[model samples]
Target chain A: MEAAVEMKGISHWFGKVQVIHDVDLSVEKGEIFGLLGPSGSGKTTLVKMMTGLLRPSKGVVQLNGEKMPSLKQLRQFGFMAQSDALYSELTGRENLDFFASLYGMSRKDRHLRMNHVLDMVDLTAYASRPVNTYSGGMKRRLSLAASLIHEPELIILDEPTVGIDPVLRQSIWSELNRLRNHGVTIIVTTHVMDEAEKCGHLALLRDGRMMAEDIPSQLKSKLGVSSIEEVFLHYGGGARA
Target chain B: MNTAAVVKRILKQFHRDKRSVALMVAAPLLVLTLMWLVLDTETSAVKLAAVDVPAQVVESIETEGITVTVMDEAEAEEKLNEAEIGGVLQWEDGAPFVILEGSDPNTSGTIRSTLQKQLSEQNASMEWEYWNGSSELGLFDYVGPALIGFFVFFFVFIVGGVSFLRERTQGTLERLLASPVRRSEIVFGYLGGFGLFTVVQSIIIAAYSIYVLDVFMAGNFLYVLLVTILMALTALSLGTLVSTFAGNEFQMIQFIPLVIVPQVFFSGLFPTEGLAEWVQVVGNLMPLTYGAEALRDIMLRGSSFESFQVEVYILLGFTTLFTVLNIAALKKHRPL
Candidate 1:
């Protein structure tokens, strides 16, 4: 299988303070890769670098063997930032159409894509409502649908399901699995232990360092732990030791 | 103790953010000082041309501490027409016939009064003649063009800066940076979008100033539109450029005293004669200075397009420079 995303010796700094130390990671094509860490463990920073929103201080990020942040490569990925990033003044359909135009989609394609994504996120009924009137969960769902409107080959989601209810979260995860089955790569960053278990592979980060990277079950068995939480605490505590 | 805690927090924030503190306090003070200096400058003596005057009349006119240029009758008429001489005193039937350069009422009035006093003292019976087939206008007429330019610059700067700053504060700017769109495209898009509104705004403001307010208008209306549009573009670009430094809407408002106010002071709203050379240079650098000068030429003096070409070019240069700088400033958000 080909690697869909690659970061080699990636490190980032804000001013003089290092936020993401030298790190290497990759996501295989058609697989869901999860980066699990507590808040401030550099998950957002790392994801930002991969999405080309930020340039790493010392490393190269490539998508499909082409350098990332290349305008050409940016067209291949969808991004859902931690913040909703929706235009509050515009209606849900308008926001989707505006973003779709930016991707150079035809008018007909934009309409079809908007309907499809709106239905997929269960926001079809609220398509005409202004986003400022949306509840937090609905806004999150709209943001998710926006990321998928372009039907990018890779989707980078930063805490995509943070405020979602458990049932909705399950549906979102299942949707991710369905997209993966269609040969889409997904990179999700979350601190929730249960969410980590659903990824095909996981990178557990602590204090800006990777504590462990393996399949969820292998990471559990290697530490002789029954649950992913114990596996995290064991590796996290061992790093402190 | 609560008051003390609040005061301490305010002081700490000021110390941490020196740029905001400096702009808030220093910008206004600096502009105010410049205004004081410009307004307080001494008035220079008015220059007049004496045409075919008797020696006694010329001597009497020269006694009033005014500068007199002796010329032939035709030369004096030409000088008055060109606005080079404030007024011309020519002998008609052994009496004084006065022709005044009537564009600026203050200058024309000074010349008329000075000549009238000199002719009375000389015991010469004189009849005054009117030029341009009309009486002198009010001071408001002379300054109306500058006022129009100043208000457009003032309002557009505040509104554009605040809106852009709000976008930054609301996190929409970051979202824009995350897309595949180039930074230059965003800046150009803003220019294109806002340019549409400003066109209508300039037309309304210019029309109101000309037709409703009854301000002086001697040049073509289309020329006024050209100058107003250029002025609006300059303000728009500067507003967006400065928005990069402002963290919020309030901070954007703070720029009025720093950026917008100084332009008014130097925009020929007030006389800059006898001001310090450096003070005059500062006004020369401001975009509104050229705009106001060009507008006054078109509306008050009925100047032709050739007369305003330089100012038009300078205003366009200012807009282009500010737009490029604004695009560069966005690099702080996204390197590419």
Candidate 2:
């Protein structure tokens, strides 16, 4: 099978300020791929390109070997944006139902799928409550549930656990692991070091350029460093020198 | 199918927002009632026609805030029938005969009372007849139809624009565009959902104004509902289109002055005929201009559908134009 996402010679500019430089990367199927980058390192831009939200100025993005911006293939992946993009006035279950219907799911299947995602996100009890009343972490989990309501084969998440507590964050990571075990492809962008360490493969990005692409152990071991942060510092700091 | 999903989501959101729903229905009625109370006590200029009447009598009537135009009997009668002049004053057998265009009771009463005072000085009896409405028609009855159109347009524009802008600032619009839902589906879904709700609003406002408020209704109530619904749709489309340019709720409110306020000036609340040529053209461009005219024609004149069909078609045309522009604007978010 082809990689879940592939990008070659990708570059992007917003009205003359180039945000993403020439970069080539591929995400293999059925694995948790981490895009490790600092703020403004173009992680959001890169992931947006993969989801076809922003077309690259110069690159080809293919998902499952199909050239992207393909509406047919868009139904194959879920995307959770950085912000909780939900109607605060609507209950959590209503939000999920609305998203599921977008994918043209039938009523019975939608009910079943909605229940499954709500249970997985641990929001089953609070599902009927309006999202405005939800705490930050609960809203984050609800957003995750909405993205997964359609049960897409691939998922792209941007900063999914920024404001989340450590315990909930751990649960969310374990959920990712479970999904991967079931053969779902996942790509997550994060600035946190330990979260990068959890990925099956990592791409260290700085200044819109990929500094390194390897497994966490290989990247740290090869650099003679004790942690992913040191390996990142060597690449990021050395590049400036 | 995606459009239906969008429509469902919007309906759910609207239901949850009880304050907005109440504001949508109540605000218009409150303003209309307040206006009825205020403007009913106030007086307006009455234009009268004079045929073979003494020049001194014309000058005297003009002092009572009545504008008198000296013309032949034929022209005066024609203007009275068309409701151009408030009344016609003609001398027959050394007595004054008044033809009052009685659609506006305030105007007709003012003219009759003023004529009675002026003509009675000559020790002559003054007889008056109604050209359209009776002496019982209040000032509210004359302006009520136009007010209905204005309120519907105003409330829908504000409510629809602000909600759509919230969708943008809240990042839900980006999430929506990220879906496989087509841009046109978003616009049409807004239409379907908000359009249905506006239909309900239109019915309530129309019924309340005609039945509860006791505004005069000469035509079928169904036609009044139809015109209000179409006018609301026009407001919805234009509102969504304007929200595309507004970055926030405040910015959307700023458009009220630029978009909604001008419609008030042009929408038959004030007469547009005597205005400058370009001003009349500007009024012609406003949807409410046509809406108010259609409502007044149906409610006051008791006009048939064929008489106001042009306004119906024009309102639909405005909605279509705005909807197309809104769909095109979404291309900035996602090309496909």
Candidate 3:
């Protein structure tokens, strides 16, 4: 069976500065994969490449065994960028409706999926309110809702839970687990250590290079450390952290 | 297919932002009204002092609008110096020589032309004929077509460009690109949404100018709408293209002097006859020049579409070119 996501010898450069060094990655279906890194560790750039939002300077990116940057393949995944990309002038429901339609959802399907995603993000009550009136945490949840409205097999989220509170974060993680149990593949990028622990598999990246890739507990055990942060420190990733 | 979604969202946003809609629709009427008030004044009556001139000549000079006061040389000179009279008309040598108080161009030009018409008509040797517009056409009437084109271009450029810029700065554009939506779809979606709004805007502005303010409309109103709509689309596409380069709203404003104001000078507000060759070449490259020319041909001369088809095609070509540039500029965000 084809892996849910696959990349080989991926490298990217923004002008003279190389942001993503050579990297290889593969994630199996029905697994929650995490990319852990500091702010400038190229986590966003790497995830953007996987969605064909950016073309790598050199490499191949495939999702479900299909070469990316194809519109047909693009319909199979959803992306949420580091910034909350909701249209503040629109109601929360309208924002979701717009993205759902872009995925070629029917009107009836849009109504169903919009309500479902809004419920998943705990935004059903505030769905009719303009996003500009939403609080920062609310906006973050709404963005997450928009990304999931299409119900793609794979979802790529960049720092999805940045300003969200602990309770909502727990709920969101539970939702991710629920989706994973139903055979959905997930890729998430974050700098939060505890959040990284929730992923079934983690890749610790620093300075555009992957330092280690393993299950969270196994990574700590192999380094004889008690926490993922120590395992990160063990691999020279704590200079700024 | 997703273009409808984008269009629907834009219309909803416009509905929410009533102030911008008002700016686009009503502000032009206000400015055009003010321009009519200022430029459409009745020709102020010119008062002339006739000195040592024959009774028949003075009587001829005192025709319709011009009123000639019979006086001696000293009285006429004193009145002229006091600025109470516009000019001193006296016989010098064998010819009728007039001394004009040249402070105001309008009054002095009127005095000169009045005297010339009267003196030349003493022989009844000259006949006047108008080939196009009557002599009653005011400054407002002459420049009204261009101003309509200008306002449509200016407001649409600012509103459309800034709106597109907000999508970039607010990060929504990147999110939109992440979908299966094609780049051309996004461009077409914006064009359709804003294009519909501008159509209504242009009609309101054109109707108010022609019917209420009474600026001049000799040709078909439908053609005027057609030209104005094309002008608005040209501005819309150019605005989106410019937004691709603008970093923020402030940068978009900065383009007014660079991109818009020069078009005003070339847009038929001022005569380009004496301008340099290269300068006229630059004006030909601007979309407003063609729009203004097409508008004037239709509004002033009542020319048929065949006469201004070149301008029509050029405006369409400009829109197509800018729209293509807009779609290509999206590549900066998403390679596809």
Candidate 4:
């Protein structure tokens, strides 16, 4: 019943140029919410606010009804930003161990979880190799593994599967669904049509504003289109302007 | 736990990046060795050119110095310009005219007095008196303590700045901020890990310069180590702080000319005694100035810690200010 993340009238500015306009969004606990938007749609900014890395200039961002940018609330999040953000000089296993320790996981827990995530990402063999030697897709999988190393209550992934191979993408989506079933709220940003279909709840955004917020089937039917892409374009066609 | 985790990760990263590690040690060692070789060589035999000097005078000067060539006055002047000769010993107006090349004061003084000593028995200009030290001090003795501070500051500043800047450009800094780690914790974590590395580096460099290179060491070795470590911390903290303004490693490299080069000029590497009064005030603003002075006082002057307490405290002061600014700079990424 509780919302995992809530944004009320959130507007942000970088100097004089506004990157995010007045927008209201919320994701309930245990649901797979997708923030579907094209590039420069302010999805990254919104996700950053959700993770408490940035503060809204005009409005409030809340996690579990507590004001964000709070250290206590930050512990609940496992954030995977778009840029991998990994130490390329470090081996994959070392990166995982580092992230695991930051969450204060026990040695035994770290050992087990590191293995589980590395196995899930199918990077078990290359775990000992430095990340710089990894392919782009391998790096993405490794980034995903690092985010999930702590098994936090919420996982915020920004374009989590952008460069992932199709087979690995499917496995990652299934893993995300498994996390959802286990009551871990996930908020992912993507422009992929099928990936948006996988989210239980989707918010269509254009520019800095949200165009629609609804289930994928209901949105497609309401727009009289079978594909999520048409529904995306239909709602993003200035209907909410 | 978060700070320790950060320290561990930095150490792990450093272990993996062997080139950077090698650079932190080797770059400074190479420069230090080159400088040692240059200054350590006994001043090469002074070269003299005989133009219009009497034959007996040329013979006497040769015994004290080297004879590059015998030529006319015009030819000797050309050799002086090309540095082929240290000086042209020749007559000008007739009273044993010594038209000497005066590029280097030390060499010119030697040439002038050597000629005068050979010619007249009464060219004694002034009496010599020993003040703070004896004449046993070599050129390396004068520059060694100051140069020790310089290299520590230099290598540490560059390594710290470029590494911290990499954290930003590579997005690991954002990654750290997104985690439960505090901004101050990140800064302190860097101080711990890099602090340890620089400690090891200081020991190696100071020991090598004092013992291996045989640079004149008169005072306490422990004090040299202490000053070296503090100077390293100052550079490391200041490097991290300045890296906040740099967007990439190249930008961090750009800081060397603006920051490191000026400190060397004022850090007692060269004599600042005859410089303008305001220049001395400017020297006070540089962290290396205090570090070099502290090192000199400990090694050259043999002054105790209590005597150089002000300089030590100033080095520590720079470290603290830069660390606080580094923590503030992190707010740009996390804002918490």
What does fnat come to for each candidate?
0.28, 0.59, 0.80, 0.79
Model 4 quality (TM-score): 0.85
- Residues B99-147 of candidate 2 have per-residue lDDT tens digits of 8877766678788778888779885667878877666778789889989
Where does model 1 exceed 4 Å of error? A165-168, A238-241, B1-101, B113-119, B123-136
- Clash counts for the predictions, in order: 0, 0, 0, 0
**What TM-score would every model get versus the actual structure?**
0.84, 0.91, 0.86, 0.85
Q: In candidate 3, which residue pairs clash?
A: none
**DockQ winner:** 3
Candidate 4, residue B231: the lDDT equals: 94
RMSD to the native, candidate 2? 2.8
**Which candidate tops lDDT?**
2
Write candidate 3's Cα lDDT for B68-96 as tens digits.
88889888777754446667777665457
Question: After TM-score superposition, what is the CA distance of residue B47 in candidate 1 from its true location, in Å?
Answer: 6.4
lDDT of 3 by residue, A37-115 (tens): 8889999888988888899999899988888787888899878888998888889998898889899899999999998
**Predicted candidate 2 versus true structure: per-residue lDDT over A122-235, tens digit per residue:** 999999999999999999999999888888889999999999999999999999999999999999999999999999999999999999999999999997889999989999
The lDDT of model 2 is 0.88
iRMSD, per candidate, in listed order: 13.7, 1.1, 0.9, 1.0
For candidate 2, what is the TM-score? 0.91
Off by over 4 Å in 4: A239-241, B40-129
